[model samples]
Target: MEMSELTALLTREGLALLDETGSVESSADVARSVSRLRAAGHSPDLVSAVVGQARLRVKARPKFGEFADRMLFTRAGLEQATRLSVATMHAIRLRRAGITHVADLGCGIGGDSLAFAGAGLAVDAVDADEVTSAIAAYNLAPFPDASVRQGTAETSLPDEGAVWLDPARRTAGHSETTRTSAADWSPSLDWCFEVAQAHPAGIKLGPGLDRDLIPDDVEAQWVSADGSVVELVLWSGELARAGIRRSALVMQAGETHEITAAADADDEPVRPLGAYLHEPDGAVIRARLIGEVARMLEAGMVDEQIAYLTGDAALTSPFVQSFRVRETMPAHVKTINQALRAHGIGRLEIKKRGMDIDPAAFRKKLSLKGSAAATLILTRTTSGRVAILADRV
Candidate 1:
């Protein structure tokens, strides 16, 4: 369809036009549709509606296809943006730390920039891709002073209060290459360090970013939502405390785990599993502060090799859940099926760790029935694969 037709359709439908044909050939069709809609005078509400609908439809199909749309992999020149949760957290941290001006490097779709601006901070948001920059401008249009520029961090950032760099980790022509090591990251630690030296800066990195490469002068933080670690935040300048890395678990309702590295100093101590076992948030996991989490709970590993931490006392750790182990077993497909059958199991809550088998497939194979319900955890300990029947503590 012609651009005018697409725009008119979007305006009439009050939704963004997502040409399936165009989306299939190149996901840029969505961006083109958005541009056409804009040129034809469609409102952001209408455009967002259409795009949101298309995204939902696309995501409902297959995981890989969903990734394509989400990552903007099919788009010729669009850069996918960070998730809202991560952006909001970053903004919160920046504001809390009293950062007033920010250079948002790789500001795709301007999610982080908008959050920063909304938090009353002056922001210079930059992207190398023209289309992405334009979209970011549109996204940030409501903020009167927020500037959206098009260029790489090396050329775009100005001397400011702090620099926020989220480098493109995915290589060109590949969608699954999500490595967070300094070696794999674009704009490199060298570039980030240069920016940091110029001004106090914060770099948004993958949760799995290598801890060893983290600069000694900077503070490395892992941030999680609920009990899952989502991203790593590296801070430079006065904010970086010596030998005191921080890990945070943030919940939407404002619960947080602000753990310092010093908590783990001296020999690692092991405590027995308590009344409750709390899983650390994903951010804590990425920060590799599981040992600290265990300490916080006064807990020890269920089996040394497993991520499961147990304690005799109930403690607050936002990285993991506090589950009451109701039962235990040597896990086997046949044995598990028999146990479920014996319990008259119908509904199964399956959880796994250190296991390669697909849960859905295992559930299907069991063909469970009856009214019994149980939480099944598949994990490896110092011993080996075992199943724990657990209840939320």
Candidate 2:
């Protein structure tokens, strides 16, 4: 979003028109609104900004819920904003730690700041981007205790208070931007680490961050929401839990389950394929807590290097998606197709690990033409690569 468009949209007529425009879910709706507004003598900049924001509000609903209606957003800002549910958890953690005021450095679109204020904590949010800081202030307008400013993370640091650091991981732009490497990240990971070490802080990082780069003393927690691993956070000082080096928090169906260990748990020994196969959640795998989950299910690894777990028990947990084995055969596509056809399997869900096959490409090679549906698990074992036909339990 350009500064001129933002200037136009912050006025009375522009905001009124945005509310009157209602929901714009399609390009056709945008076109109609643009034409209608243009015909009615509205400026092109105003029309563009209002219609563009309407479309963004529709897209932002999944992350921000009803709050997206009154809030403002830039294209890149909306994409990088944290989900409200996850941000609420962070706020709750700070509140529980007896922190009353927080300085949110590198606060993009003020997603976390909104949660902090909603949780009854005072917020001082700062973003280097001018438009993003403006939108953040508008979004946080309802909370008298929250404030937003335009400044770099370094210059905006407060003398005292807990800190929430979210270094910008993308290039400088409000509309379209590419990811910046760890070295190029604003406020740099090294500087963020120094801040965390000096004060009680929570540093949010990408889930796929290299494990070796993590500090030894901070508590590392990987979080997954509704089956997708979202973020990894490093906690320091009072925020860090004692004796817990790694943890996985899984949120699904409105319920949260967490597993914590002093360190990465040891993997279970590889064993023969059992009656049931369990696929661990991404959070569990990222946190390297699969052994803890395996112990809970009385399961063992399917391969020494594979993440798939096998067990004779038909047990299931929130940590894994379990399947009951029906048959096992060679991994060859022709033989697997023949077995699938013989079993009258029509619809198939292909899952693969420890193999190079692309599920989409391999699915095209299958001769599926029956009434039954099953899951085809393609993985490698101690013996060899095999295809196990199973049904979700």
Candidate 3:
């Protein structure tokens, strides 16, 4: 939103109207609300901006929970902003490192800064965009210890006890951001690493960042929330573990699971598909800790390079979703179609790895017609491409 509209939104009338209107759940809902506001003689810009923010608040419920109502967000800022739960973890980590003050470099909308302040730390939050920095200031106003600055990180580095950096990975506006390569990341990774070396720091990065570029002495942690992989973070100095170097943090509901290894493990031996198929959690896979899960379940990889595992027995754990293998089928879509028809399978949940195929397009070609439902796993063995039909266990 433009700064002028934001200024209007902060006025007594605009805020009262925005609260009175509550959340706009959809585009049609926003349109209807806008029409009603215009009929009431509200300015067009005020109506548009407040309505847009209301819609964003509704969309942001999953990330910020009740706090979303009190927060302002840019479309791009919300996309890359850390969820409150995850940010709390970062704060706890910082506090444990004896950090009483934190410099949140590139603090988009001050999401992490909010968490740090709540954790009882004084914060200096910086954002390059003026409007974003202003919104961050408003959000952080409740925390007297937290302050925001509008400027580039290179120009406005906070001299403080510790630092947290979240480089902007997108090159476009919040509404339509384009993911750029690591080289294009703002407050570049090289610069972040340099900063980390000199300060007790943590840097947030994309989960898919190249492992080779990661520094040798920091703790690299990949975190996932509610089954979706989120950002990776590198911790250094006091924030870094003494010996641990890699970790995966899985957060679901009120439960949190974690796995760690000092270094990558050797690949498990490839074996034929077993009675059960296990798909490791995304966090585990991202951290290269699949072997740990395999060992826990007494399973082996279906292919030495594939993340899919096979076990003869059931596993009771959160690290992987186990499926009972119903049958093995040919990888050919036509043959699979016939097999599905014979098995009375009308519904299919498709999963693929180590294979080049679109699950949605292939599902359409099946012309599915049956009373039964099942999951289809398409992957490769050392031998060749294979299909394993299974049921969620």
Candidate 4:
């Protein structure tokens, strides 16, 4: 966003106008809102920024909830910001570790800072972008303990005993550029790790971070919020666990579930298909904790590399979604469609692993007409690609 646009957005007039405009659900709605605002004599830049932010607020509802309506956001910042629920976990961890003050380096729009301050920790939140920093300052206005600074991470590092760093994983501004690999990070992953060693620190990273590059001594925690694996965090100093080096944390609704291990867990033995199947949660798979989930279910993997698990007896756990095998169908698309028809199944939920077919396109080809709703698991076994018709258990 331009400096003038941000300045305009902060005006009493702009705030009143934005509040009145609210969220527009579609392009036509947005156009109408924009036209009304423009015809009412608002500046072009002000209207554009307000409209863009309104759309972003709508997109941010799932992550920010009611706060999205009040909070300002850049597209990339909204996408990269930690959900408030997940940020609460980070705050609790820091508090438990006896951290009273934290330096939130590379803080984007003060998402994590809000949680940290809400948990009674003092936060010095820093962002490199001026516009984002300004928005963050406004968003964090409610918490006096939180201070947002428009500066680089290095310069804004406060003299706090604890720290949290979320390095920029994208290019400048609200661009959609993905900063692949550790070196692309704004503060660099190596620098973040270095700081973590000296203080009670947590560094947020991509869930797809290379396991090989992870330091052996730190606690690497992969978190999935509402079924989506959002981030992997590396903890060090007092925040790190003594024996545990890896963890899978799952957050859904308001509940949090976690499983920790000493290292990347070993895979369970592969076994043939059984009466029941278990699909491990994304966090479990990302943390390589599928073996741990398998043990909990008294099951073995269907394939060594695949995360799918099978056992004769039904088992219930939050770590894995359980399903009862209804029938085995041929892997071919035509045969699978015929099998679905024979079973009187419609409204199918297609789940695929180790397969190349597009579920939506394939579903369209099937022309499903039955009244039944069932899950179809398209995956590969040692015998090759197979389809398993199943019911949620």
Best by TM-score: 2
Our model 2 lands, by Cα RMSD against the true structure, at 1.0
Q: How many residue pairs clash per model?
A: 22, 0, 2, 0
Q: Each prediction's TM-score against the native?
A: 0.75, 0.98, 0.95, 0.96
Number of clashes in model 2? 0
* Candidate that would win on lDDT: 2
Model 1 spans with C-alpha error above 4 angstroms: 1-79, 172-185, 226-228, 241-243, 252-255, 263-278, 314-316
- Superpose all Cα atoms of candidate 4 onto the true structure and report the RMSD in Å to 1 decimal: 1.6
Worst 10 residues of 1 by lDDT: 70-79
Candidate 1 per-residue lDDT, tens place, 1-393, comes to 123332333343542244431343236756776777678776675564455435433542332223334222123222245555566667787787788888998776676787788789999999876656765675577788799988888887675587898887766331233344556566777788788777778887777766676776777877665444557778887446556766555654455447668432332344444455555556655656778777767777765555677766756645567787766678887877778878887888888877887888877877588997878888775556777767776
lDDT tens digits, residue span 1-393, model 4: 677888888999888888888887889989998899899898998998898888888999988899999999888899889999999999999999889999989888888998999999988888888888999999999998888888887766555578899998777877465665667778988888888777788999999988888998799999998788999999999999789998999997799999999988888899988899899999999999898888888999998878899999878698888999998867887888788889888789999888888988878877577899899999977667899999999
**Model 4 has how many clashing residue pairs?**
0
The root-mean-square deviation over C-alpha atoms between each candidate and the true structure, in angstroms, is 6.9, 1.0, 1.7, 1.6
Off by over 4 Å in 4: 365-367
Q: Which lDDT tens digits does candidate 3 get at residues 1-393?
A: 888888888888988888888989988998899999999999988998789889988988898999999888888788788999999999999999889999998999989999999999999999998888988998899999999989888776667689899988888565787889888889888999999998899999989998999989999999998988898999999999887888999998779888888977555778888899999888888889888888888889998778998879777468888899988877987888888988999889999998989998888888578889999999986557988888998
| 248 Cα displacement, candidate 3 (Å) | 0.9
Instruction: Judging by TM-score, tell me the better candidate of 1 and 3.
Output: 3
Clashing pairs in 2: none
Candidate closer to the true structure by lDDT (higher is better), 1 or 4 = 4
A best-first ranking of the candidates according to their lDDT comes to 2, 3, 4, 1
Among all windows of 10 consecutive residues in model 4, the one with the lowest summed lDDT is: 173-182
- Comparison by lDDT, 2 against 3, better one: 2
- CA lDDT scores, all candidates in order: 0.65, 0.93, 0.88, 0.87
